[model samples]
Target chain A: EADIYQTPRYLVIGTGKKITLECSQTMGHDKMYWYQQDPGMELHLIHYSYGVNSTEKGDLSSESTVSRIRTEHFPLTLESARPSHTSQYLCASSSSDRNTEAFFGQGTRLTVV
Target chain B: AQSVSQHNHHVILSEAASLELGCNYSYGGTVNLFWYVQYPGQHLQLLLKYFSGDPLVKGIKGFEAEFIKSKFSFNLRKPSVQWSDTAEYFCAVDIMNRDDKIIFGKGTRLHILP
Candidate 1:
């Protein structure tokens, strides 16, 4: 089983509410990523971190922001949640070793009403 | 930019039927290939991967994939599929000498009927 974990497996919040999705890993991986996915659709990378204090945006532009202050934790925050922000957020982590596979968390389903 | 493509959007098959899902990448240099499966209400799991030699790679749950460099394709196959095999499969590529980010394809949904 993967050591990565996402909090609040499901979330529902009103519009304009500030919310943060938590992600943590115990594998001591150097790389962490956040992806957005919809029902029956492909996952799109939104943000990633190489290590502490290192963050980069992914191919898909996202309104949310992420921070990697600790090696095992990478949290994403939405300034003001909107209906458009409603989607499934998945967190994953992988070692820096070459050819290694990535492990994923159960994912958080966010619903902005 | 490196990108992965899965030709089939959705597939339906019966139990004990052969299965093949097509995947192609657009990179010329060395690349690492991967196949990930997501069962219902479950997180994505690594089905198989190809990093170096041996184009033919086998994975868990009786799944396998072939990496054809000439065709820039890494197609997944299974001799006989079970109804429990129904899930979403994603093809991903990690281009060496580039960023560490792994690009994922749109994904293929497989539905196996009993």
Candidate 2:
């Protein structure tokens, strides 16, 4: 099994509430990513980080912001949650090697009320 | 404008039947290909990958993928599939020197009936 972990495997929050989803990895990877997915749908990359202190927005635009304070931790935060934000959040980490493949965590299923 | 395409949106098959899922990418460069599977209520996991060497690569659970560089396609195949193989399969492409981001195709949901 992969060493990545995501907190609050399931969460239900009211609209306008601020929340943060935590992601951490024990593999010491240099690249981490956050992807949003809905039931029976494709995954959309929302944010990614190269390493500590470097974060970049992904192809899909998202209201959530991410920070990379340490190599092992990359957290995503939403200023105010909304019903439209209900989706599954997946965290993944990968090394910089040419043949490296990403390892995903058990996703966090968010429900906005 | 790099993107991946999965021809089949959903497929239904009987146990012990042959399986082949088509995947095509638009990028024309050195790419690392991957097939990821997500069972119901489970996280996405790597089923197989093709980085280099022999065009055919084998992965866990009897899953295999063939990389056709000329066609820009990496298709997943299985000679005999079991009910446990029912899951959503995603085809991903990571273009070399493109920040190492993996672009995923819309998944194909396979339902294998016992």
User: Top model by DockQ, which number?
Assistant: 1
In the range B41-101, model 1's lDDT, one tens digit per residue, is 9999999999999999999999999999999999999999999999999998877764778
Interface RMSD of each: 0.7, 0.6
lDDT of 2 by residue, B4-112 (tens): 9999999999999999999999988789999999999899999999999999999999999999999999999999999999999999988786567988898999999
Would you estimate the TM-scores of all the predictions? 0.98, 0.98
Root-mean-square deviation of each candidate, in angstroms?
0.8, 0.7
Runs of candidate 1 exceeding 4 Å displacement? none
Candidate 2 per-residue C-alpha lDDT over A14-92 given as tens digits, one digit per residue, 9 for 90 to 100: 9999999999999999999999999888889899888999998988999999999999999999999999999999999
lDDT of 1 by residue, A58-79 (tens): 9999999999999999999999
DockQ of candidate 1 against the true complex: 0.83
